[model samples]
Target: MTNHKLLIVGTVAALAILVAGGAYLSGRSEADRFAQCRTGNVAGGMEAFGTDFTLTRQDGARVTAAEVFTRPSLLYFGYTFCPDVCPMDTARNAEAQALLAGQGSEVQLVFVTVDPRRDTPEVLTTFGEQFSEDIVGLTGSDEEIAAVNKGWRNYYKANDAEDDQYYLVDHMTNTFLVMAGGATAEFFPRDTPAEDMARKVGCFLDAAS
Candidate 1:
């Protein structure tokens, strides 16, 4: 074969590889963009609050964290089907609740489900109440769910091709604190200890009041 022909063939192969590489990279970047993880730089992070939601409690009564707790709010984002992280987060939230209770700190603990397909209103009702009586689980439509996720910068996706199977919600495991007047103040990541969170809440309340 002529050297010129060989060179042309090699160039064609390289171009093909470049194109394939570019496609792969694009897909990977999209995946990473959708991924959500806890904040590590600061001891506590901030909430990306979207539009406020009015949801019914387990008892079929309308409520919001602000309307119910009325003091300060600690919000946890997770789903019911979570095998490990969700339960751990709830337990940690409960621990924080207990710590605050021990200190007589009035803090509202709220749990929001990222995967609402399986974690319907009923699922949320049961899952949240297990941790603490104060814990409330709320549900909304897909659009509302997406809006909340975007507002909070949560990472989650449907696990199955069909809607029957539960979805996997990937979100920053941060407890957002909504101080007085439904304003977001600070947030505690999963790494922070429950005791520290309780203390922070106490301090915030003391300063606010």
Candidate 2:
């Protein structure tokens, strides 16, 4: 298999193990609080995945996770220069966001760039608008971006290209549903359909409410 396929398979396997281990250790009965909303298990429940960090918005203003995740948000990490995977994955997220809006559930869409050196705020802004007006594109200094990536446990590696402006980033493609206060409700893989994503997100929203 190619490196990209191998990376995806490895990530899925790792997450599956984490989820299973967390479920086993929690020892909670099936009568959990968000039990009805959960279509699948999370590693350690709602708070397993997210962390506190700051990033620069497309407008070049710095914002904290608290400010960004004021609502149920779909958060993704990718670069604007990514040739194909990032575009398609983020478009899928936008479609899911639209579906939720039509059903009267508002969700924020956040895209953070992993390639901070290349993805300036202006570049990110243009890229995000191609997907959705409400999409909040974010980039930060290299240190800041690395911190957030570490917090989210996402992978990203930039290739050493002869042309600095043209390069590809290999990164994970998991879209996280993070609620207010940075608690992750669920995570959707790259291949999840928009319809399924909308349904699952609605379940979390309803259960939260």
Candidate 3:
């Protein structure tokens, strides 16, 4: 009878373990969980945010997403005209890239303008040079810019100005660190220090090599 009681207890314990495991799995967000290999992380029952795009490079050539994201890249979306936030954020991103370079990881810094009308190729090229000559400044038609922005879950709003041509654009400032495979593997908040950002990026660069 003692042996029989022990078996019953063991069975109940096994069932409890199974229930707990199921609960843990069910509670996780899709992005928080791992899925098949074709896509990046699977979150919310869908692939995580990395997408392909075609836009005009600052050099006046049309480039596809794969071409731009060919290597590990830091993507920032803002207009060159911003008096403050965009410049500061972009400078910080450039600093992080320099930090990564110091550690032997070459990460491309690609700046995409949300204000395409005002940010022509020449304008973007000049603005980008102020940060780093290596930076790739991209501008596209309005439709192309909107599509890429939507895919990346980035937001920008043009504030009303008496002269619409000189309006201010309020945009999201998170820097997206896309892995080599063209998938948005990580994102660093605007406030993240260069050292901290480099440490996070190094993890991926290390693994890639």
Candidate 4:
């Protein structure tokens, strides 16, 4: 009789567990959750806050937003030939990465090429390694670059007259702070202090979790 009772209890527990797990997954997939995340972005409209983008990583591997979708991602748009703004911003991002590491916070850094024409896969892979070990550089065909830029709300322009002599990219200098999973949680503009950037990322990760 004890064996019979034990078997019944175990079966009932398994059924309950399965039912609860299904419900939880269903609730998370509901459109409302993502919709709320999208609506919150419209006031100033955080471009990094939205969902959708996959770029080539610094190691010559393709990275999708889905890969880091559950982690915080700091995104920047620039080209390797950038003389000033890009380097300064990327350096700051590297500092932020170190700060986060010291604080035990998890974050991912992404660098998307604005001058894909010249920032080929080989150049980006080599140049990106010089900035930071954790920074991921991405470059793609012009059409692919344009689609991703629009999705992320990034801006870029090319100069034609002197294009052959010098790099012809003038991209936005702002850095995008994106929370994994939830689109457009917040943003840090160009030159945000490393300490402040780390704090914001911590808060976003905590709240997002």
lDDT of 3 by residue, 1-209 (tens): 69999999999999999999988877763344322222233353223565688899999999998888879999999999999988998899889899999988899899989999899999999999899867889899899999889887889988856779778998999888886668776777788888888887887676555
Q: Looking at model 2, which ten-residue stretch has the lowest summed lDDT?
A: 25-34
TM-score of 4: 0.73
lDDT of 2 by residue, 1-209 (tens): 99999999999999999999888767554235567767777566656577788888999998999999888999999988888999999999999999999999999899988999998989998999899988888888889998888878899988856757687888999999898778887888999999999999998888777
Error of 2 at 122 (Å): 0.5
Candidate 1 lDDT, 1-209, residue by residue in tens: 89999999999999999999999998876444312332233333343453466655555666654565466778777888888987997888788888888888767677777766676777877787778877767666677667656665666766666645654656678777776567666678788888877877777666565
Which portions of model 4 show Cα errors greater than 4 Å? Answer: 1-44, 47-51, 68-70
User: What would the TM-scores of all predictions be?
Assistant: 0.70, 0.82, 0.77, 0.73
lDDT, residue 15, model 2: 100
Give the Å shift of residue 151 in candidate 1.
Answer: 2.4
RMSD after CA superposition, every candidate = 15.7, 15.6, 7.3, 7.2
**lDDT digits (tens) for residues 161-180 of candidate 4:** 66554856867776777666
Worst 10 residues of 1 by lDDT: 34-43
Give the worst 10-residue stretch by lDDT in candidate 4.
Answer: 31-40
